[model samples]
Target: MGTVFLAHHLSTDPSALSPFALKVVDKSLSFAADADRRARWEISVLSRFRLHDPLHPFLPSLLGSSENADILCWAVPYCPGGDLNVLRHRQNDSVFSPSVIRFYLAEIILALQHLHGLGIVYRDLKPENILIQQSGHVTLTDFDLSRSLTPKKLDPDPLHVACSEPETDSDLSRTFTRFVCPRKKKNVNNQKGLRKAKSARVSPVSRRNPGSFYERSNSFVGTEEYVAPEVVRGDGHEFSVDWWALGVLCYEMLYGKTPFRGKNRKDTFKRILMMQPEFMGKQPNALTDLIGKLLEKDPTRRLGYRRGASEIKEHEFFRGLRWDLLTEVVRPPFLPSKDETELTEEVKKGGIDIRDYFDKLKAPSSPLWSPSLDEQRHNVSLTEF
Candidate 1:
């Protein structure tokens, strides 16, 4: 929806001094209206997360923002390790081991849980949107597609009760006291590798299912391959859609591809509505079983539909996981090296001005129309999709 630039912020206050990903959109563009709205919505969501005493570790913190007659801009902490998709591509088989997937998925679930508690539905949940922080932990990004809906009130259940106090050190430690690592299994079919393919992003579908649940969004949004079946059927969706996408993500991490991808978007949506996820192993393991439940076509039958993330957390696949000690893990699946974290001399002195870069783009006839020095050095450019 907007372009992202790697820029350095210089300030007298040490706390404000750091490199940030500056996302900017030219207000003069034809599509700027919708993009502007999405940007503001995303900022609002991040600001809401900050209201908590200690912000959710897996969520982004809005650093600053700016606006003018021609452009709008906002800054977020820069992730040096890129995103999960890039990290997965770097792996030998372009897939993660079960342990690595478990670690990342645990953090992601907590993030989603916090969001659900606040009535937010993270419609988009894919590897590209999962960024690895400098600390080697995962933080979700791209909240533009996220929607806020009122949660349904159900009969009293212990699993549905919300935590009264913030998670204290003792509370977290207690939760992890019985943690145990899962045993690894060897994949027999390693020779047949899957090719990297981009998922389709289609315009919102027009159909709507009025018979669907009350707290549901009828808007057809999300990447095609990761989209939920209810969304494809225009049957409305809520928090369960995120779980469905999570299943797609987990399957992709294990098998190197999405479960329902077909030759085209039509065929893809058809498969999503009709087919079951295929597994490589003959026997059903905890991980496969978890994916199967999460990928359930019926939103009501989905694993996280009723109790939200709590239902997913109770699955055998995540048994004995130290939910609270996730941040304490000294080593994660992957960490950015010293070289990746280093900034160029030019960036150290003073990064390029985002406003000036957009101004140059406005003047097509100017010499700056060609790739500028900053573009060559930092690869800064406008991203529209």
Candidate 2:
């Protein structure tokens, strides 16, 4: 829905840092109302984390925002090291080492744990959304797709909402069987992309505030590859979906690609429902076991479903972890070099004026870029970071 730009604030104070990423969304375009609400929601959510909190040290805090006129914009600390996706590409094999994965995943778990504590479910958890801070720590960006979901006893609906998608009993055993099978060999396209979506998933349109805290939403949203089976099946999902996505992210970090990705979205969704992740090469025992548990199709049986992140923290994979001192690790596996942090005069070099960009699209076309007439060609990314 918008573009991210490298920006800075002019300040006289030497201690006042200015460099940040500014995300601007134009609300005068199509789906204006829904887009406007999400923009406001993101600002509200980030403002809550603006204060320094040791528990949420890795999460981004909003610096400021402006909803003036037709544009909605906000500023967040810029990560000079770029995102995890970029860092992964820097590796010789486009994958992280076991030790590097351990350090990064440990910090991510803590960040997710803190989000769950605040009654928020982070729907988007992937390499792109995971930004690297200058301190060599990771900070999660983008909260537009996330919503507040309170923990409450799920009542049996007389309407039979729970029974709509009958739970598959034999699938659990089938999953275990597939786990031992040799993973399929990597194809040529795996080198360039971790996994790119061919099309955007259809999300429910809404003028209403994302349901109240006590309820659940059946909205089909989130990146196609990262979406959970529960979400794909359209059974009102809750906190467990995050755990499922966590499993996908873990698999990608270790293997350089998402476990269930296929030739297309249809095939990928089918794989998510019917197949299990196949580990290649020498498997990391604890880590592989942890991924299996997280990817359980039955949300109720998923590893972190009941007790949230605490259940995963106690798993054998994270044993001997020093959660408190994660921030103190001065020499993380990869740190942004001086050149990465150094600002050039052309930081905003190809940046578009968001408001004018939208205005020009609405005008009659000339030789320049214009909105596509073919319906299939137009797809919104819905990124409101």
Candidate 3:
């Protein structure tokens, strides 16, 4: 839908920061309307974050934006450490330790909480979208798939059931029975064996009446592997979907792969609806226990469904964590080197003009095409931060 460039802000003020990531969406593209809508929504969401008194530390701050006859563009601070996926690949086992996961997950939870406070549901929450700032702390990116919905009011007697006894098979079956067809009752007898059977089908259940305090979005948008079961069923989903994705993210960090990924999207969706996460250890631990509750197939029973982030923060996995001192930790799991933060000589010398570059693409095919131009264009495409 767009291209991102490592750009320098040319300004006379000495206080101005120069290096930033410039995202450009060409208005002439075939999906211009959709691209334009996403870009505008992202900018609007970031703008609201910038208005907060202390400004959310973990949410992206919009530097600026502009639109022309042919393109729409916006700028955000560049994260020199790349994204969590890149950082994880750098690890020896392509996975993070328990301590590392806790630190990063804490910051991510805070960011998601802030978005929920503003009535926004962040539909995207995979490792690729969690960028590592220069300080090594995580910040969420890519708000294009996000939507605004009224958050559910906190229940007066919230169910603090995350650490309660695990749900029995009967309980689980009852939670999902309404979504499965009555004719498929025979399949319920073999709940343990359904993981291997590809014939079973669970249809989506539409909500008859949505609550007045909260609005649900039926838009089916999210990365296939990280999507919630509710989303896969096309049932209207709310903020709990993020919690489900968080569980997927946590599982991947510990096990080096997603819990229920199948051979194809169809099989994957089937696994999401039926299969349970397979933990490696012999006994239950705080981390795995937390992931289990967060991955609850019923949105109403998910860990953060009732009281939001507060419930997760109070879990054993995050016990003794000084939430207020996260930013002051001084040492995160990974930090970018000087090379990663330094601007190239070419970038320092005013870099490429984005608008002018797009104009060249529209020019006649005479003497303008060259190997160097092609190389530069490739570089621009690969430099998204």
lDDT score, candidate 1, position 210: 25
Q: Which stretches of candidate 2 lie over 4 Å from their true place?
A: 11-17, 51-55, 153-214, 346-385
- lDDT, candidates in the order shown: 0.75, 0.68, 0.74
Give the least accurate 10-residue stretch of model 2, judged by summed lDDT: 172-181
Error of 1 at 160 (Å): 14
Q: Write the per-residue lDDT of candidate 2 for residues 128-165, one digit (tens) a residue.
A: 99989998899998898899875445334343221111
Clashing residue pairs for model 3: none
Q: How many backbone clashes does candidate 2 have?
A: 0
* Collision pairs in model 2: none
Show model 1 residue runs off by greater than 4 Å.
Answer: 13-17, 151-214, 362-385
lDDT of 1 by residue, 62-164 (tens): 8888787877888888888888998999997899988999999999988888887777889999999999999999999999999998644434444333433
Worst 10 residues of 3 by lDDT: 171-180
Error of 2 at 278 (Å): 0.6
Cα lDDT for residue 2, model 1? 73
